[model samples]
Target: MGLLVPVSVMAAPPSVGSVSISPDPAYTDTPLTATPSEDWYDEDGDPEGYVWRWQKYSTGISDWEDIADQTDNTLDSLYFIAGDQIKVICTPFDGVESGVDVEATITISNSLPTITGVTIAPDPASTASTLKATPQGWYDADGDLEGYVWRWQKYNTGILDWEDIADETDNTLDSSNFVLNDQIKVICTPFDGTDEGVPVEAVIVISVLDYSGSIDVKPGSDENPINLGSNGVIAVVIYTTDGFDATTVDVSTVKFGPSEAAPVHYAYEDVDEDGDTDLVLHFRTQEAGISAYDTSVTLTGETDSGTAFTGTDTIKIVPSKAKESVQGNEDAPGQNKEPGESATGKAIGKESAPGQNKEPGESATGKGKNK
Candidate 1:
């Protein structure tokens, strides 16, 4: 039993019962924190602290690899991504020696991508122009590669809802597929080859293409005279020129004069004496709304293919005899006479009877009459 006098015992290293990581299910966007159980103990009852080591499982290396400069208790989200396994080792230390390592692991979950600055170009899209959808910024927290899925839709008045355009999956839409006044939209969805993000959209309205064409009012007549008081028809001719084809005009869509009068009748002919065929339309004079002060009138119509065109021609508005008689009476003093009386209150010219033809040498006003 020798030196039972001074037998000294060495203190055991500190040890912890278990370790845990907060946010058990990890995401790429959030930071992770490791915590050790308070049940840690030291044989010598010395103060206890922990040394943390972070690591990640590498599929390429088929083993766990240490993360550089990440020995702290907490690990940053930027270091890992979805489908990645992250672990932290916590070793309890009592200043003299370190205890067995306690590890906690978590697997990162899939994260969605974000889309920013989505826009449709050609700011105001037109039926004759192509439309393109663009996204200025696309981001994914998990550092995943990104792709886009595009879908185009239009507002349908018949269904009173937004309907998807058939086979319009590309980012660009052709001009032939849309029409004026049509409301169009493009949707973009971002994916990371594993998951998809919230979709972003851009909207626009189609506008008409205004063009000018040649027209002749009262075709073949040098003076396109219009009697304001007459209940008759006025003929208008639309000519086919270098780029415009009058034959393509949609007769049902033609509108003329300030009244927006529609055509009561239509025909095809070479009214302009040109070899190309032209469109001839007839509109009721009373319905044309032409005024004596209107020097020019406009005709607007669309082609069968939906192209809008406009033309203007000079007009000569003529007043009726009744209107002329009233004007003459108002302009002359003491000239108010009956329908058959002269301005002097006389019954025509004493020599010439009503409806009688004037002699070859005599003037109609009773001037140069034979004695």
Candidate 2:
């Protein structure tokens, strides 16, 4: 042997044989733990400890990204979702150097989401207002919330049962589709990209909105006198106030007085001198059915948006001149005449001198006073 001398052999660095992730088909609801195989070999002895590195593959960037602050052996369920690729690398560490890296990966499976609450607004739904549905307490273990699926239903009075509204799938329902006293319902279903969750529902009854407005009878006249016997049209003005708009009133639906007479004509003007536009409508006086004894008048109508409105005002029913003329003619015959005067206000039978007594037949010159 060529100079056989005693030589010391150096031990190889620690080497990791294999690493595995528990629950191979990982789910979003469960935590994932990494385990290293005991088959790790080192000529010097067992390795001191292990070093772990976690990474997630991003489909958007098409690359592997290291997860920060995830050096631990366990990854919480909050970190991953369905279809996510999780990988963990384990390396055996000796006193001097770190050995070869071994890794294990698992694909996260889909999990169902849960919808805990559903509500509709505004709380008191009205025919003049739009109703909107809102989903609350949405829970998804996978941290993926795509959107919601909405379905609308109405309780059909004709059928006496709930029926689905055709093509009313939006979260917001317009007032035009429903009327007063209609029962409306909205169902909300939450879903991820892959699966849908449990559904929740909310319901409300449609009500008619009541709006109070100021109305002026006869436009400029504060007394608002009405002649029941007149054959002309009566004018009424609906004022636009801070809380109500007169222009929104439907002309065809306007009714005035106790007779509920419809408007024959309408126009827009600033009747109250408030600089705001007002609605003026005309109804037939005879058709209004306002009596001379009536002290007040009321106007009722619906808005263009289906809101109901009512207004009342004091009125003084004035006597008609035609009736006064008839009364004057009836009194002209014999009533209110002086003594011994004819219907024409002259002395009866003959012209009598002053202080002369008249017999049964008085002469014209009073010469035959007792003849």
Candidate 3:
């Protein structure tokens, strides 16, 4: 019966095939999922179980890694951070001639960025100011962020005389040169990954201003217009042609009265000062008779960012009349002469009349002879 002795055969472990990723091997701010393949029984028909690990590097690495220490099943659904280069492997139980292993090279790019906050800044500020701007923010753990840009616009034109004064596209505005009392506006646009991020606009809506200056013009300073009832009164035409420059003006958002003759000018020059001179002279109540009436006009400025930096000027108008305007030489020959009093003669026309009485040294016609 000793020859009848027999032995049973034991099974070998299952084999682990190649490991790789699906959809894509490289990811940029995205999660990665893996599929595994293995037989339940070993070469000898024994039961099998698997052990898995997510390896970032080979054996020489000082540390070993697993999805939740190999105890987790969410391995395929986990999110990967930027620049993560990894591999996956599976070992089958019921020991075999060789262990089963699956591996694929994975590289993850920059992930989605997070926008934390934003801001705006200006440069070269002054009594008459200009503005320029830029922005800032935050990011995510596994992801990275990129560059930025800002967009902007004008605020209101209803209150301002200067409409084209603001230029927010490049982010800039100037007010020193604009007529006073103008308002400026601005906003910011952030250039973020995937989509347009958030926006930051002006913290202060409008800039108001009050300046210091005083000037008085009497229209006729050069021997002025005179009115003596029928004779006339000597009215000095002294006056400030252009008033003192206004301060803190937002040029982009401004408006003017509807018409030149709207009756808003505060002063006039040579219209009614002299009875005869006023009657024969062209009655112009405006600047150089160009507009024919007293009026106001405006100009504006910007500092690059298009924000209202300086306050407005609110230009003041000066009122005037022919009686207060400038008069040539009234003492000349025919000036105010009774029709018969002087043949002071038509020879006494304004140019000839005044020149005839000039001292040889005061006459340009005598320049060569006098010298």
Candidate 4:
């Protein structure tokens, strides 16, 4: 029968729903994956095979160019550069095309990260000063401003190498150990969890103030003791380092011996006349009798804008003795009598005793015994 030979017709081409892409926000020189939705179907209920094709939209040519072709349901190992556009097409067939061709397109937008304007505070630094670091004008495609990492480094004196400072992270640095003529620098870089951007750096040279000096007790030595009267005064002179200014020294820090002795008076002088001021401190002796006593002196403070200095010395104190006088005349030995004494060792006005003569020229006090 002619009615039994019915003809079988092919179905429409395959149709797919919206496409999905992993890592929607891509960065420079990175990978991206595109997946088709499960809503894809063919008019023939099922297709023998599925085809996936990828193409890149070229702005220069104002057209799309084929990039890859495969029979799988998904595509991978696709790298997109900055500002690149991608497109994917899917088709299903079972001896005949079914439904319409499914297509999806995505624009790849990626930019590189940048860091700039790394800075340090307090250009001239010291060991006692706190140095600060400041960075500016840094941004990335991810729009993360505070995602920057920091590190500090120091340059060896006279050496062409740099050393990384341990535990010196963030935007601050511990300049406590920095010495004169030391060179220091800081580096800042941007991090977006998966990648690191370019690095920016800044450097500064350090200058430290020195206040090294010594203290000296006058009229005293390591072996010899100082001689002072009952009420004597002690004199102390302090010598500072070549570049230190002694005039700004704080005299209150000068201590005499274990007991803190307040200086009776203090002055500055150019003892060596080298055009720099040196310190001089005067201290009144204690009521203790001077009999070879030990005196420890120390100077613990100096300078106003520089580092303070410390000096100490040990000294001895001795008492002064008066001279003894003899109660005798110039012509007599161990006696004070008038000139021309009698030979019998009696005064001229005294009466003669026993057989002794009482004459002024024949007295025992005379220049010589009577001939």
On residues 295-355, what C-alpha lDDT tens digit does candidate 3 reach at each position? 3222123323343322221222322333233233444333333323432333322344444
Candidate 2 vs candidate 3: the TM-score winner is 2
* Residue lDDT tens for model 4, 162-260: 988888888887756476667888888866554577888999877644222246544112222344442434555565445555677767655554455
Model 4 whole-model lDDT (C-alpha atoms): 0.55
lDDT of 2: 0.71
Rank the candidate models, highest TM-score first: 1, 2, 4, 3
Ranking by lDDT: 1, 2, 4, 3
Number of backbone collisions per candidate: 0, 0, 72, 16
The candidate that achieves the highest TM-score relative to the unseen native structure: 1
How does candidate 1 score on lDDT? Answer: 0.72
Error of 4 at 133 (Å): 7.9
lDDT of each: 0.72, 0.71, 0.37, 0.55
Could you tell me how far off, in angstroms, the CA of residue 233 lies in candidate 3 after the best superposition?
29
Show the lowest summed lDDT stretch of 10 residues, model 4.
323-332
- How does each model score on TM-score? 0.52, 0.40, 0.36, 0.38
lDDT of 2 by residue, 1-371 (tens): 58888998866789878989988777889999999987877778854578888999999999889888998799988888788999999988877778899999888988777888889898666556688998988888777865788899999888898899888888999887787678999989998777888889999987644332367665333455666766666666677778678889889889888899997667676544456777767777778878878888888888898876667777777778753332122221121222233332222112322212222344324322211
Candidate 2: segments with Cα more than 4 A from true spot: 1-32, 36-49, 58-71, 75-84, 91-102, 107-116, 127-129, 135-147, 156-161, 190-198, 207-371
